[model samples]
Target: MNGVSLQGLRVFLAVVESGSVSGAGRALGISQPAVSGHLHSLEKRFGVALLDRDRPIAPTRAGEKLAGHARRVLAATRELEEEMVRQRAPGGTLAVGASTTPAETIVPGAVARLAAECPEVSPRVRVGDTEDTLAALLRREVEVALVGQEPEDARLEARFVEEDRLTAVVRTGDGKLPEVTVEELSRASFVLRERGSATRRAVERTLRAAGVEPKIAAEIGSNAAVAGAVAAGAGVGVLPERALPRSPGVEPLRVKGLGFTRPLVLVTERGRRLSPAASAFIEVCLNRDGR
Candidate 1:
């Protein structure tokens, strides 16, 4: 074709960063075919392989050379975009709404990157359950949202960022327990997230699927609260592994048949163009400088 495309560079970089075509599609909010099309165009334009299409994907020697240049160009373009954004709207606070998992884990790092990218923009995060965060987005109270659950509304779009696994944790000094079947796990009391939490929904779905109607010891709001309650001997808390307490008082466990995972997604209003700050934050969240 003509010269190389910025979209091709982004797709190649995404594939390189995520190590899979599907992953690049997810990160870019595009279809797999779209990602492959961009990659094909890039390879056609360069007339050389940019990626080694094998397990644990990596760049070819030529690709390594291209990637260095691509990063510089993409980064330069990003800077120019931000500068233009500043000319349009110089400064404002970015209201970020997040569910418990991402608020505690992912948003902080993304905010750090955004701050470094655009110091003039301030970021403020409001933490809530998944439903709450989505509601905030619907209401336009927040420019963007990070949530563990996918939004179902037609007026909103969600992009996959990562997955979070729910793990069963117990107090450290409470002593170990033998393996338990789903039936036995059903009998045990759980320190569960509050009703609206995506973690609670996935955990319940898995438990119910296994013929276990979860018995709750307590309903806690945040991951840390549940962990704290469990560490205090309240009950077994099911939380995202990322939220598992690294402290000496708490430890995770393996149940014989209980396991669940949920997607972490970035959500925004559909059909509406994102603000510059919101766009910058999402880019940082999905494709950080260093993989």
Candidate 2:
């Protein structure tokens, strides 16, 4: 019992689950000989044959009792590890990649508050279009990704932080009309974000669904660019509400049939264990009030 290791217990559990020495080896990605060695070591420690050692192996009464204790030990060890890590102050750099909307809107506030709580962490954010941000996350350029659109890949996990709504903006005093139909706006030239921008895609999809295609005056990159073009009388621009404060000389334009909302998400590599700093960053992001 003194030398009975968590690893040996794991091997024992695998054998019990698989019901064969060779099957347990295959399941555990170990050789059959290694499996047998662990089982032998475990049995020697207890001075009892844990398994019947026959085809479709079965556990003895002692093995059943030991397996239960092993399960508790492993579970308790995992809990202890998690609790200790959580209680300890985490300190490190947390790399994050985000699309334009989330980068400007969420990352700044989240990181600022995180700094207040855990000053040791430095959060670095790379801002790009949705396509590029997701690419950076997949390439390991960032430990986390904040994106406007939910990622579809199975290998990446997305956690919804908030819902973002899009609004149309026009140069101030361009028209006294406070509201216009989608059909009316369809006739006017539109300042748009460049393709691969989530806001642009949402605007385009919404317009297309209304049976109208927007007339492009200019296709610019980033929300600021789009707003600037619209402010300079380029055209009507669609932007997330968070970008509104940055947009000067542009007034909100209500376009009927132009409603679009998307969930802002925090994304990470599925099944990958994150560092303490990365975990803290995610928690901060998730708890941020998207004001």
Candidate 3:
């Protein structure tokens, strides 16, 4: 404990979480030999085995205890640094990540509100799909993420921000149909968002629950692309009801028994301390009217 290094503790935790020395090295952007060396040094300092290097490695009891303490130590250190930064300078840059729906329809306004509310802070926003947004948060590419689904990672804290529902849409002039039943939707060709998209996931989950499999006509990554495909009569597509603009060529339809509502969440790494600008942006998001 006397000679234990903070870097060694971080390396150990990374190994435990990633389940392999190689994996930890990749995560920490280090070499496997370096990761092994750190683990060895920690074990030597403690005079005990820390990890059971089996297939899918696990930490020993003593290692688990150390991990808990390490997490606390790291969290406290981050908090202290953040406080110091705030005390030294009130203004800084805030990096924000958002999924498609919020990125396209909500984040710009939120950034504007943040600018007005916290005049000293500048906000930088990155847009991606739900999966990518969460990944950006994990990689520390952004301090906060606005995403469609609540993150399952215990290391992340998610706050409910807003709710959005998916609705079936088609080209206006080509269809007399205003609404679709589960069976009809299953039978119809569909233009869907790519696999990791929250809208696509929700729609697929709903369809599966109803014992229907969608016939996907095209897999589009962007909402605009999906909308365009639907308007071009490629197939029916699902989109956030609020995000679907009133296009003369596109008609939105209610899907019977397919009420897919997803929460928009603001996610931050649980043990990480946010910068002043990030904290101000979060406050702005929470207090903003109409979400």
Candidate 4:
């Protein structure tokens, strides 16, 4: 306590500038008693009477000197804070990646919000399968990655940022097919993402639980491709409803025994923390509406 704390200095400055403990408390959003306590603490720490606390609280001679330095420190700190905020604003370009589904539905809106909040920050988004997104994070290719589940590698730290319910996407014509059984889904021709996709893994696992082996006919690389295949009556697929495109071809149908839901993650290297801008973007992504 020999060296005055910034908080103490700030209190000191507020009191000096406002010329009253009550006034200083109002300015600092603190109680008047708290302001008095800080003044006493500062005086005891510096071993000098810093304020005339009788009627109109004014800084003594030593208090004036300390007040001046406090103003400079506080002013400089304010400038630094403002600059940090600017650096965090989304006006600059951020490298980001997402798996097929979230990239289409969740990320675009999050990016738009970031863009609006920080006009200076632009994001370069890459759409890929989950494996690609995880690989990019490992290679330091992107600042942030949004993907389902997470890779098992210890080099990366995965955070559960979002959750999406899995749905059976059927041809619009088949949408009315009454509550279908998991066995029925297993028998239906299935379009799925390429191997290594977390969503595909969840779909497979859910089918396995039902004692039904999924008859996956096509291994598509993207959600769009899978949706297209299902729309073309190639096969039905499991996907998140949010990722569905605004086309007339396919419809998401709810099915029983399809225990296929997965959490989405935001990942970065274990020790390598994100840049301020990247961190801000991660926050924006986490703030997305539940899908």
Give each model a TM-score: 0.68, 0.68, 0.67, 0.67
Measured with C-alpha atoms, the lDDT of residue 194 in candidate 2 is 82
Q: What's model 1's lDDT at 165?
A: 84
Superposed model 4: Cα runs more than 4 Å off: 1-91, 245-247, 289-291
Query: Model 1, 251: alpha-carbon shift in Å?
Result: 1.4
Report how far residue 69 has shifted in candidate 4, in Å. 22
Per-residue lDDT over 1-291 for candidate 4, one digit per residue giving the tens place of the 0 to 100 score: 576678888888888888888898899899988888888888898899998877777888999899888889989999999998776554567899888777877787898878776667778888888888889988889988888887689898887876788788888878786688776666788899899798899888877877878887899887777888888998888877676666458887777755578888888888886666687688787776633
TM-score of 4: 0.67
The sequence of per-residue lDDT tens digits that candidate 3 reaches over residues 1-291 is: 559788888899999999999999999999999999999999889899999999799999998998999999988989999888767553777789998888876787788887776777878888888888898899999999988888988889998888888877888865576666787777789899988788888888887888888898999998888988898989988888876774446777777766777888899999998887788778777777754
Q: Which candidate do you rate higher for TM-score, 1 or 2?
A: 2
How far is 196's C-alpha from truth in model 2 (Å)? Answer: 1.7
lDDT of 1: 0.85
Error of 4 at 112 (Å): 1.5
Sort the predicted structures by TM-score, highest score first. 2, 1, 3, 4
lDDT winner, 1 or 2: 2
Q: Ranking by lDDT, best first? A: 2, 1, 3, 4
The digit string of per-residue lDDT tens for model 1 on 1-291 reads 588889889989999999999999999999999998998888888899889999878899999999899999999999999898666752578889999889888988888887787887799899999999999999999989999888889899999998888787778855466565666566688999999999999998888888888779899898878888888998877878877644346887778866889999999998878777788788888986565
Per-candidate local distance difference test: 0.85, 0.86, 0.85, 0.82
